[model samples]
Target: MVVFGKELYKIKSDRYKKARGGWSRIIKLHCVECGEYLFDYQKDGAGILKRLYFDRIFKELPKKPLKCKCGQLLGIPIIYKKEERPAIRLFSGVVKK
Candidate 1:
């Protein structure tokens, strides 16, 4: 991916256990520079081409910078380390009921 000269993005979306019609997922991708909302695509995860589609988009990284409607740089983070990716921490210690 580095060959593309673009920042890497770890997927921030959650995994769905069951999809009614098919394996549907709401993909949430943010700009690496400004952390702005890049685009949210609703897709069928079961399609064979779908995997290739996503890989082509993320791996290549669309010039790596999304622009606002005004044409200004959104400044999303270009590079993200493993630690920089966000995670959901359920509990830190014992839970009280």
Candidate 2:
């Protein structure tokens, strides 16, 4: 597990391919109190790639809380594949007010 600011993130690789292909597990946590989100990813059971990517995204994010319309903080947990590297697929939906 990796701690980033107020959130916790972790990644675990499941399988690997010969030609540099693999499945990675991503876990992200959002802190309602701090209104911050932590993103994580891993490849071939290694965290190097995930760490670098997380660091880059964190630096690019604004120093502001990401809150819902009702003032509740929003946290998104996403899964991404190398084939879809930059795009995150949401496994859950937001709660309805």
Q: Name the best candidate (by lDDT).
A: 2
TM-score for each prediction? 0.26, 0.21
**Segments in model 2 whose C-alpha atoms lie over 4 Å from true places:** 1-21, 30-35, 39-44, 47-50, 54-97
Q: Candidate 1: misplaced stretches above 4 Å?
A: 1-21, 46-97
lDDT of the candidates, in the order given = 0.35, 0.38
Model 2, 1-97: lDDT tens per residue? 6564465655333333223455444444443444444443333443333212323242244434434445664433233455433322222333220
User: Listing every candidate in turn, what is its Cα RMSD in Å to the true structure after a full C-alpha superposition?
Assistant: 14.6, 11.9
Query: How much lDDT does candidate 2 score?
Result: 0.38
lDDT of 1 by residue, 1-97 (tens): 1221244433323333133243444455454434555544344445421121223233334534435444545433333243343222212221111
CA error at residue 25 for candidate 1, angstroms? 0.8
Q: Mind sharing the TM-score for model 1?
A: 0.26
